[model samples]
Target: MITVTSRSELTQSDSAPDPTAEPQDGTVLFEGRHHHSGVTFFWADTPPGSGPETHWHPYTETWAVIEGDVEISADGETLQAATGDIVTVTAGTVHRFWNTGAENLRMLCIHASPELIEHEVPQD
Candidate 1:
């Protein structure tokens, strides 16, 4: 069965990592998610000066910038992405996000596999 979800009907959740947690710099506002069919879609908002630390995932991931600007670090390089920009990270690739702008950074993230939720370890 296929279901449709509109952006307006999507619910946002206020969740932040623990202060004592290893990755404690950012907040995640998951707009919505669909777990079936191995696909998960959600939106994440990070306030200025806060974003995800260097990390990776076990599944392919794509992120589309919705607002503000973000700095993406991947494969030993960094790229600045603005609104309307899209970025993709393959499975096992190291990546991270940084809210480099004054306003909040909003992005739409889609994961290819809902079952793969573990973060990848750095290859150093």
Candidate 2:
């Protein structure tokens, strides 16, 4: 099977906020449910100082920086990823990333699930 898609052809979705971090306010490019690939892909255009909260997924997740630099916090450690850099988080690992550069940060977030399953910390 073969498929093709462009960034401009993707639909957008708003991000929800939780107690651990601010709302990402990004777009969903190719949700795993959109196809039968068993994986979800999305693009995050995070302005300076905004990103997803501390959360973990049941499946592995990866983030590839496309435009600007991003500061990723994984399991209490922080690292700066620049354009073309990719960061991976194993299943059940706590992590979050945000724009750390002056310009808007564009990154591709991929998950190993058909649907995006995000578990925010401190579940009440």
On lDDT, the leading prediction is 2
What candidate 1 gets wrong by more than 4 Å, as runs, is 2-37, 120-124
Using all chains and alpha carbons, the TM-scores for the candidates as numbered come to 0.70, 0.79
Tens-digit lDDT track for model 1 on 1-124? 7766544553333232232334242333332233235566556767898776577777789998999899888878999999999899898888888899999888877767644364645555
Model 1 lowest lDDT segment of ten? 10-19
The per-model lDDT (C-alpha) reads 0.68, 0.77
Model 2 C-alpha lDDT per residue in residues 1-124, reported as the tens digit of each score: 7677666665444233223444345554577576557888767778898887689999999888899988888898998899999889999999988788998888888988887788888735
Relative to the true structure, candidate 2 reaches a TM of 0.79
